[model samples]
Target: MIRSLKEEIYKFIHQKNSLYGLVALVLLMIYSALTSKTNADSLISVFGAIEWIPIILIAIGSAFFAMEYSNNTILLLLYKNSERSKIYIAKFLTILLYGIVLATTSIITALLLSIVLKSRQYNLFTVIAGKTILIQLGLNILGMIIYSLFAVAMSFMLIMLIRVNAVVICIGLAWGFFGTSLSTALMKTLPTISNILKWNPLNMVFISQQLSKPHYYRVSQLSNLQLIMGTLFYSLLFAILGYLLFRRRRV
Candidate 1:
């Protein structure tokens, strides 16, 4: 398992998209900070850049998984390892590690930007929405960690089923951007089971927003703890199903 993880990490680092994704995240943060109209907006923009992490992670992860099959290298990988489970877990962990890197970059960039752009207005200890900015940032990061797990698992399952990187990426991007809206529409259309639908994975994506703004519960209809648990449940479910499909797939 350790060897497989190391290989995955090596490959992940060498992938051009990994570097490109990191650069895109930093650039987005810079743009958000520079364009903010107010000090509070600047702070929000810093963490707001985190909302894009799922989109970036999905694109990279889909391509990572698809490349092996598209290039006819999956057979070589299986031949080299002969343990499909290790390969799958390693790849998943690599993607999660990448997510962590992106999250860290966002937080560090947010701190630096806050210092440069809103030094007089706020600090990490400053209060926002009744909680310290530091606490809010931590909650945001926690929500992001859970969301990243779901996004990685979902992308893996989609790639396993779809095989085509482009199609998987398109679907993943759509979900990242509009999944919550779709969830809301469904709940309203099916008012009878709206309560149950609130636990859907799409609605779970709002964990980050709900964490930062406690009042967002009115929109998600779920407490922060419930969102965390639901997101985790879906993450595990997708990952397990994806692995099963991967194991049965012919090389």
Candidate 2:
């Protein structure tokens, strides 16, 4: 399993689409630096911004996998006696591993730029800045991993069932950009939709808006226990669905 995963990840890393994920890391750091309020705060927030970095790479993953499916390579893999589940797991793990590496790269890059340029005036040692920065990193990274996984599942669904490249990219971007709006609309409807869509990670952004204290947002609203259970439920649900679909696919 380990060797298979390693080779899968290596192939993914060497792909042109995989290189696009690096652009995400750079953009994430840039966005973090610019949006952060204080010079000192920027340092902290740049690292924190790592949390959602996986999200930026989701498009790349979708396009990559979708291409494979569209080109019939995925079918070729299956013909070689590769189990669908193993292939899906390997591809999924590769994207996730890339996310982690991307986050680390962004964090280190931001820190290095801060040191070499001394231009941002973002002092590295401010306590509030430092603490909140880490907090943001945690939030962003966790959100990205979860959301990116969402994309991975979406990729499998569309690639196998719907083969249009432009359509897939359009849908992925639409969701990536406005997904929270769907969550909000569902949450706002009159009929007890809370239980239905609370399981949706898209709701996390909307709930985040209601936060009086950013750090405590998840803890206060859902309680740590509820959040954990809900997250686990969603993750398991999507993972199972993706696996079943892949297994049952005729290609």
Number of backbone collisions per candidate: 0, 6
For each candidate in the order shown, give its overall lDDT on alpha carbons. Answer: 0.85, 0.58
What would the per-residue lDDT of candidate 2 be over residues 1-251, giving only the tens digit for each residue? Answer: 67658767777877877776787667766666555543544554454443345345546656666766677887676775476677778877877677667767766877775675456543433345235544644554454455455556665565555656567667666665676667656666734757665657665432222221255443224554455455556556666776776677675
lDDT of 1 at 93: 98
Expressed as tens digits, the lDDT of each residue in 1-251 for candidate 1 is 99999999999899899999999999988887776554754565354665788878888998999889988999899999998999999999999999999998988888787776655766668887788877777777888888999989989998898888888888877887898899989998998998899988889889866787788788788998998899999999999999998999987
Query: RMSDs, each prediction?
Result: 1.5, 4.1
TM-score of each: 0.95, 0.75
Pairs in steric clash, model 1: none
Q: What residue runs in model 1 are displaced by over 4 Å at the alpha carbon?
A: 44-47
What lDDT does model 2 reach? Answer: 0.58
